[model samples]
Target: MPARDSIDRHIAYWRAEVPGLDPDVEGVVTRMQMLVRHLQRRRTEALGELGLLSWEYDILWQLRAAGPPYQVTPTALAIALDTHPATLTHRLDRLTRAGLVERARDRADRRSVVVVLTDQGHRAWESAIGSQADAEGLLLAPLSESERRTLVRLLRKVVLASEKDGTELMVVPRSVQRPEH
Candidate 1:
């Protein structure tokens, strides 16, 4: 009914250059990759407008998700964020200066430290989350409700397959696992 998008053109080009090429496979993979990049760019722009880096917003959101008191140890945070402790420590410094977070010694363990989300930080995190959701919704607005549901289900199938394969093929390190209560 309408002209195809760039991925369609890519499939056509590949078909022309390499006979027997599987256009269906190539098209789906290419489209999925382009969609991911588009979503990432949208997220980056939304957070950047609020003066928050992606990593900063993610860390803040993680702390916020932890609920009441809104605090977690740096190690726990590092595991949740899938980042190095040193990198998170550096980010914590910037967050602290912005008054979004505060680091204090643990009362029960004098040698330990804990990170807490300040009220301002909670507000910023909420604002960022709202903006990010709006941006994502706008991106998906072109799709019908049924289309969205179908897309989500299909994507879940692919993701679950990949995750299962990954779990079978790899072993997670202890440091990356969630901390025990």
Candidate 2:
């Protein structure tokens, strides 16, 4: 398992110490919260070494892996990244200047623009993939193969459930839907 610190040890302590709680939410929800913290911290650190923040890496990686026009509308991009228009606009502006991402006319909607990954961005992403794999392997090394499959199955159930609370996860649709236009 990846090195555990005092923070990991104390997470359960704090969970148990919550002053008042709903039984159902307190279990799975709190565990998810703590797990997210652990995951994000390591992910940020691991991804940072490549000189790319998670959000920036995420945007570029999505565009590159899309494997076609290598372009997507800003709205569609925002949905993929779980970000807002203003936030996407700001990041795109930065990436555009860095020559990592480019803005091009959207053939589908003349009024809209699309983000496409540039050559440099694709090369950087290729270099970063190894680091990303290393980080993910370390993060998940604790579980056995069967346990990993079981955990993924259980998490998929929660992720696909309809949202009752308006939370950050609202950005992620219960399932990606493709409708004929």
> RMSD to native for every prediction?
4.1, 5.4
Query: Model 2 over residues 1-181: C-alpha lDDT tens digits?
Result: 8775555555556658875645546556666777778778876876677688888888887787666667777888888887998999999999898899999888888888888889998887886777767767877898999999999998877776744454555443333333549
lDDT per residue (tens digit) for residues 107-140 in model 1: 7797999898999999999899898789789889
The alpha-carbon deviation from the true structure for residue 34 of candidate 1, after best TM-score superposition, in angstroms, is 0.8
Best by TM-score: 1
Clashing residue pairs for model 2: none
Candidate topping lDDT: 1
How close to the true structure is residue 70 of candidate 2, measured as C-alpha lDDT?
Answer: 79
Worst 10 residues of 2 by lDDT: 169-178
- Which 10-residue span in candidate 1 carries the lowest summed lDDT? 168-177
Listed in order, each prediction's TM-score against the native is 0.84, 0.65
